[model samples]
Target: MNDVIRAPLAFRNQHEILNMHHLIIGAGPAAVTAAEHLRKLDPNCRITMLAAEGVPPYSRMALPYFLVGDIEPEGCYLRKREGHFEAQGIDVIYGRASSLDTVAKTVTLLGGDMLNYDKLLIATGSTATRPPIDGIDLDKVYNCWSLADAHRIIESTNEGSRVVLMGAGFIGCIILEALANRKVDLTVIEMEERMVSRMTNAPMGDMIKAWCEGKGIRVMTSTQVTSLADDAGVLKVSTAAGDTLDADVVICATGVRANTHWLDGSGINMDAGIVVDDCMATSAPDVYAAGDVAQGRDLSTGDYEVQAIQPTAVEHGKLAARNMINGNATPRGGTINMNVLDTVGLISTSFGLWMGVEGGETAEFSRPDRFEYLNLQFKDDVLVGASSLGMTQHVGVLRGLIQTGAPLGKWKDILLVQPNRINEAYLASAQSQHAALAAA
Candidate 1:
């Protein structure tokens, strides 16, 4: 339905002039998705995708479902149409890109082999954070970032086993549900003051902690594990608060750092991750980065942010492929920083500036007894952000309102008085827009 992507630079298709050799330095969904789109644009181009792990490409997000025994490993594969990569003439190499040079247009693998390319995609994703705790490398300690980690976790953890998880952030909370489902004795240690601190507001995070504690979980906030060591047949965890606990397994879900270590000497711009333009192009010529490794434009704030969510990764992958194929392709506008988390039985969501911007207004209502809450952020008359707990249906409207920058007019006043009328406000606003369009 749309044509002419119109990139910021002059461009040509790879197959138009010659068969372009494209080298991709990752095999996650983002990398695989890019390779597929490139194949569609140039059927005869040379495409090589490198996988840091030995196993087939799988999703780290699906690892939790696997831990809960909901699906097999194959279910985590991005595209399961057999031989998908081979069918597209894309070579899947198994190794890491140890070194790269933009001027030389080459990527040196760990084994000293080199691959020259016309375009390079850095989609190496991220790695689990190994906290600087004593005995953190013990056999029973693990992180749930890769399929290999999932395998180790599911194998070691069992029914009625003692499990101590460090960090109650998003990734940590996600695995909390799965570990609980396995009937393990779970205790969560969070350095933050509340759960999901980065995503939910203070009130909502406290509410979630209370809910989890009520659900028979031992949630310890404002706490840290000072050291961990094996004691006899169990692991002993020492806390910064001078407390000790024992566990059959210790999990470090502290968070993640982007896989940008290889770019230290590559002269690529980076803040939290690889800084890329709207075309997903890095500072280096013909070099691009996407997925969790990329720090791209944030639509809501108009700043660069790492939106590591799956949808953002898939979109980034496609957009990067467009620029790699034809430099004239349209640049990506940006991606919203959003998160919808399902922790055990409770659902929470945060979108845009959930922390509320300065000089802005907020309308929030909470029923702690009923496990329901809603907070709306407004800049002048326009919705800028929102956060909610146990309000699944309202999430869509909240995102819509914030994204569209809708002028609620009198509806804003109504919502401030009666927060429950959010659905009605959305409907009325939509109807008004439709009527205005019809009149036009």
Candidate 2:
């Protein structure tokens, strides 16, 4: 183990000791993981986590199941044991961090309190994007991002209640599955041509669309919700295609935006998110950003991008913590941004830059009837991105290769020529990698 020790500053001759206090903003998975990693590096250092939400850091990804009551509230919690942070001597502050003074190394809370820090990490995640539609403020309209939103949706659902979801993205699709399981009359309206258009290609989208429709969930594609109205006790949604649907509740899963408004004028490089270098360090010294708010460089494209997934966020936090404690010995490189969704008996996985035409040639394989599809896009004979549906085993192999940027010349032939024959090889490679990492 590295000999990193977190300690407080010592005072001498009337000069206050400059204790190394790590102040982490946000209590999401990234912040929590960073805190734990920092503790491992420096057990005695002071660590404080400031969160806008009053609840402790929980699994936001599991909100869909919680909405349908498939999982209890406690199941969404990240910690397995009680008083996890307290046991570690880490302080958790329940309040919003309104502004950050990068130069002064201070953070201002919503209640007028300020805290100083030797190093600051901004991991404030993201919030769902609500579109500018008429009557959006009406009751029964909800956005699915927080635990409170899930509870509200769960409370609103009852037998025979009609629920309409806007946007057919991952959140929307997963929520549809959860609600359909409860026999809720569900309707999905998407502005895009197919479901999960951003994450998947057309074949995978069609597979999900067919599956959802087979489950009696009405899916509207290439449609836009122009306005929403309240008709007596029910809600009426008007679409751009001159179609109207009635519902008892509305859920919006349009998209997400990074929580970086507070740092607009704080001298931090801002694009779609706060820009950070490989070390997760901002342009200013002693200041770093991670998680969804940090626009770290994408290894595949060499461009700053925000990947709002829990695993990536946790990895970012761990890397940032390591850099901070180890005096920046190791370079903080980006990883493959991948996402997996298990919805209604279909497993879908995607990684890297899927849409861009620049990287390389693309290869595809599909079995529409069985809802199986695989698309590999390569650049300079190197695998860059892939989308797979109904092929869970193959996704694992592709994800490994993409992450390692391994030479796929030999593997590609086996994968493309005799895919089934190479299953054992894929499993062996994956297990070996896992074992090596565990040993290290």
Alpha-carbon deviation at 287 in model 2, angstroms: 1.2
Q: Which stretches of candidate 2 lie over 4 Å from their true place?
A: 1-18, 355-359, 418-440
- Looking at candidate 1, what is the lDDT of residue 19? 76
What is the per-residue lDDT of model 1 for residues 1-440, given as tens digits with 9 covering 90 to 100?
A: 01111122112244435778888888898998999988888877878888778767788888889999999999998778887776677777677778888899988877677778999999989888988879999889999898888999999999889999999988889988899999999999999999999888788998999889887899999989999888787899999989999999999999899999998899999889999999999999999999999999998888998888887888888889989989836686787778888899799988888888999988999999988988888788777888889987756777666666668889888888777788888877644455443332
Candidate 2 backbone collisions, by pair: 6-42, 9-19
- Under the 3 Å rule for N, CA and C atoms, how many clashes does model 2 have? 2
- RMSD score of candidate 1 (Å): 6.3
lDDT of 2 at 344: 69
Best-performing candidate as measured by lDDT: 1
**Per-residue alpha-carbon lDDT of model 2 for 1-440, expressed as tens digits?**
11112223222112324447888998888899999998888876778887677777788888877877778988898786877887786677777777888888898877677878888999999889889989888999999889999888888888779988899887887777778877888889999999988788777899889988887889999998899999998999999999988999998888889999878678888888888888898887788888989888776778789978777798889988988787666565575688888776688888886654573677677888888777777665456788878886555666665665555555566555544433554454445555543432
Candidate 2 Cα lDDT to native: 0.79
Question: Please, what is the TM-score per model?
Answer: 0.91, 0.91
